[model samples]
Target: MSLRARAATTLVLVAAVLGLGLAIAVHHDPAAGADNATLRWFLDHRTPWATHLATALSTVFAPMWVAIAAVVVSVGLIRRDQILDRGMRVLGTVAIAGALAEVFKLAINRLRPPTIDQIGSPEAAASFPSGHVTGTAALLLAAALTVTASRAARTTAITTASLLSAAVAVSRLYLGAHWLTDVVASIAVAVAAVIAAPVVVDAVLAALRPHLPLRLRSMVDVGGRTSVEAAR
Candidate 1:
């Protein structure tokens, strides 16, 4: 494997292991002392105005909304550039990350912080890997990779995504929607997804291209040219 592929694979494996270990740990004892302490600290420091701000931020990053925004943005960008491949990779990263987060939440079935401590309406979904943080991190990072080509631009994009994700993580914690470990695991998963998304999507499209009908195959651009162009 190339160095890029190796790094992505290593990060993904590390994330998976971290997620699984946290899941098992939380399953045995959902209320880990450190998590409780962090939640309580946020709760203790929250003000009415700050609570409202955090609620709005957290709501914006809610998994469902994030998915909707991703679709809209991807579609818009693809239409503007006529680059189906790039857009798909960007959208796929966010979608896959969000789906995995939901699956983990269901399987882990970890509870959110105590309802009484929450600043807004309680979330009905389980909260092991935070849906908000995962969605926000994935979308921002994926979009960064899609929109920028230079190494410097990529670095800036990653930094911006990380900062925005940190904001989302704080929002989730401030609202008492998730534990500390939940947000941490989500960041790891999002990073892994961002790193692997392009490679995975490219591989899938390449493998499936030969089997697709000519008209359909024309929709895919390989190496900066459409299949139809290559044939011509």
Candidate 2:
């Protein structure tokens, strides 16, 4: 199957898993018990250094930092390669993933764990989907997808991004700010966003082709051909 098809299949499977988990969490409250247990375990094992490190990692996904990162990375990519379309695709993935996470948050409206139950200050927002994980996953996945580098470099980038995303997700759980399923669902959403980004970018470029100036149109045509070739 094609790459996009694989991605779509992965997304469907992850969504199903998340859906089943959410159903259990909502209807039976098993997830809450599990979440509590996990938090207890973390608390039992916690040290000052570990807590500090996790908190630091978690900050990378804060909304302000994420926005700044998106701008910096997108602009850097465009400046380095002059691939405006590709840069936009990266930015679009971050935006779409973040928006989708928020929509899910509002829809689920699951409350965060109580402050007395957690190591850190209480979070007041819905916690079914961890925004930290979602944002970090989206940013990392976008970076991995859009990076133009050697095969080894690309592999390394993807691996590092995945690791970093997982670390951030774990940090949320460690802090008791989110349930396990919250991070899981956010990951599913991030994967879907990353997979759909290029397809969406291509469609947008196609629609704009007719309106682009002749010089710019030719450049796009060449870039499109090169992208297709690279995929092979």
Candidate 3:
């Protein structure tokens, strides 16, 4: 994609992300149900085992100070497999972007639902955007990018990613850790990040392309999967 095209794509995505972020923030009605019955199904299976797993997976929303380790570990592992390069890009963007969502939350200092009223108050702290949703979204995107081992694998990847991300969002509400807006914003942030990553990666990859040996550059290019997407 041309630089102008890339810039336009990024602008569109950033605008959408920021727009969705604002929408979720302003629409923070405590009484309203943003709950999706589908996602709450996971909580039904919420055994101690599930909670343990959920707790661990949920840390993608960890404070920036703590997520560094996971990011490092994740990148290190993915780097060995050249095919996994996309995953590293996805996770790295997710880590940085997810942290930003948290920072927004902390700055907004939005109150959790329960504190405002039994039904909850729109009493927001800086919590307009949710980090959990953001992190989960990034992770979901990474899975979508990587887990195409087969038709089954692809199906599993999309379903699991959606469920996990949605479930995590729901958990935040159930735990009263965040307002509904926080969860919604997190999704918006994640989608924004997803839309942002490819365009940036393509540019960086293209620039680094010439310096790398021809053999390596060919491998790096990944057969033009992103060229079309980036242009759009």
- Local accuracy of candidate 2 as per-residue lDDT tens digits, 74-181: 888756554456667788888878887887787678878777767767798888688888888998889887655578888899999999999999999888888887
The C-alpha RMSD of each candidate to the native structure, in angstroms, is 4.2, 3.4, 7.1
TM-score for predicted model 2 compared with the true structure: 0.85
lDDT of 1: 0.76
112 in model 3: Cα distance from truth in Å?
Answer: 3.3
Supply candidate 2's per-residue lDDT for 227: 39
TM-score of each: 0.81, 0.85, 0.62
Instruction: Report the lDDT tens digits of candidate 1 across residue range 128-219.
Output: 78888988999988887664456898899888888988999999989888888888878877877777777777778778868866544435
Q: What is the clash count for each candidate, in the order shown?
A: 0, 0, 10
* Alpha-carbon deviation at 22 in model 1, angstroms: 5.5
Error of 3 at 42 (Å): 14
lDDT of 2 at 189: 82
Score residue 21 of candidate 1 by CA lDDT: 44
TM-score winner between candidates 2 and 3 = 2
Model 1, residue 36: what's the lDDT?
A: 81
- Off-target runs (Cα >4 Å) in candidate 3 are 1-17, 20-78, 99-109, 114-125, 210-232
Candidate 2, RMSD to the unseen true structure: 3.4
